[model samples]
Target: MSALQVGLAVAGGLLLGGVIAWETWNARRRAPRQPVPERRPPAPEEGERVEPGVASALPTADDERLEPGFDTAPGALSPLGPVPAPEKRPRLDALIDVIAPIALDGRVVSGDAALAALPATRRVGSKPFAVEGRNVLTEEWEFPIAGQRYDALQAGVQLANRTGPLNEIEYSEYVMKAQHFADALGGAPEFPDMLHEVARARELDEFAATHDAQLSFTLRARLTAWSPGFVHQQAARLGFTAGAIPGRMVLPAEEPGLPPVLGLVFDPRAALSEDPEQSAINSLALSLDVPQVHRNARPFGRLRDVAFALAEVMDGEITDDTGQPLRTEMIDKIGQDLAQLYDTLDAHDLAAGSPQARRLFS
Candidate 1:
């Protein structure tokens, strides 16, 4: 080839390569930044012992199960990080529920039979209606599981909850469901007197009303509004994860099955937007359902700290539900009040974060 032609060819190739590189850089610059996953510490060079870390993104379709780090019990720690154990829900208690015994004709029922006979909804007029069987082998009360034989079964409905005390209608519905449940299993249910249970429910409800305390603070953008990505990214840095619902992020409790320690919620529409980056979010709420979290988790402290931190990072101002900007003194006062409330709950034996408290508040 001629020298002139060769030179021209070389220049053409260089120009094409430069254009491709420029396009690649520009595309990346325009693309929304993704969350940077919090990497877990490396395992002891032995092998793949999945040491789960803070979840940064939703699990892919192929994920085998709720990624590990949740099987551990509350407050329990491991070498890697906090492995919040899944909570084994509390069983039936006569103090909190109206109990009824099901006579199984002295005949042990198979687990499948018991499960099949239980009520389908597991709820009776805003109260939790549940059935538990006495394990034939261990004599322990539990929800019937496969491969077990049950010698006895009991049904109960919660006496009171945040919604208020169980009334006559709810008690009657409980009775009907429990009776039907027993009949389906060829057994008979002996329920407590509706009047007595209703009275007990009212008393319990009064006590719960005095103790229940849920705190929330709104974080409003001070100057520049934030994108959904900015909010989520900041929360993730503070050990938050994407919750099941949109616009909701949570700092998971040390106990897995229990409700989250603290929750942050903004605009659900923004979360549902086709391009979250383009959505501007001006305000979000940080909340703590006091009774739902254990005292040891220091949920109140975390709520306060997170609110302050987010406000600082996101250039926001913290305010009450009434929209009045909260000063530091106001926050401290609320903490003091929370402490007193905790004392009250503890005195009633429904200490915050206990299963009973969680159930009652819920």
Candidate 2:
């Protein structure tokens, strides 16, 4: 071959190799990253302890080194003043329950007699069933207590839940349970028209399906992966504590009985691992169930703040399920939309975070 031709061939070979190398580099960069095993951290250092708290807001967002204040007496949270006893869940509401009134014919029924007449289980098919008695003196409807006297009785079954709308089978089951209980107490029971009530369930389910909203953001490690202990320690500084489930943390509501305001979750496997520090967790999740939390608690805002705060301290990036970066504009827009949702729920008599709304949404 001519000398000029040989030189051109050599130049072309080098250029082709360079192009392949560049493409490979870009591919690796774009691919999702895996977790890197982490080592155990040192003991606590000189710092302010993060006080354990959960409510409308944390004491302060910037504080680090938060710790749970334990009561020497009963292991209760002390800083919050003995962690008030969890409040009783609210009673059934007619708006969400298919109620059946039982006429006792002026017979004074003992609480024990009523309790004995209750169904073997409180559930009628997929819905929750409750029986309330009208106290003779107080004139209030409540569950039968062992020693109380009641003049009237009523039973109710939930209309809808996460499982779906009430159907023929469930409504029938409710009727049977109510009838059996009323017969034992010698009370005449009256239930709504089944078909009509079932229709109401469908409509309510439709509204719920359209309005139900839950938000989640995944935080992927930007450099080094996190260990379970590391994740817990960092979140504790922000007033989060170990939640009921493994690998989950919760920001508690100020109201003892209310559902948590927000959740922080990581890989369960890592949390359960024998050597948690050696188990790498590449991603974490933050979530909010809008209807479960009260609007005054500002759940969405708290979730946003916690997400960004954790990302900054942990050297991570907040992304969607697909790992795409979640932009600030999108997050802000969600907050605005949530505000509108809260208003709609309020208009429907199921305000966000209210007991009635919580039960219906459940």
Cα-based TM-score, every candidate: 0.76, 0.78
lDDT digits (tens) for residues 186-232 of candidate 1: 88889888898899999999988977888999999876667788889
Show pairs that collide, candidate 1: 72-85, 73-85
Off by over 4 Å in 2: 1-87
Task: Tell me the spans in candidate 1 whose CA falls farther than 4 Å from its real position.
Answer: 1-87
* Model 2 weakest lDDT span, ten residues long: 67-76
Clash statistics: count for each candidate: 2, 5
- Candidate 2 on 129-235: residue-level lDDT in tens? 99999888899888998899999999999899878899999999999999999999899999999999999999998898888988999999996778888788767
Q: Evaluate candidate 2 by giving its C-alpha RMSD to the native, one decimal.
A: 8.8
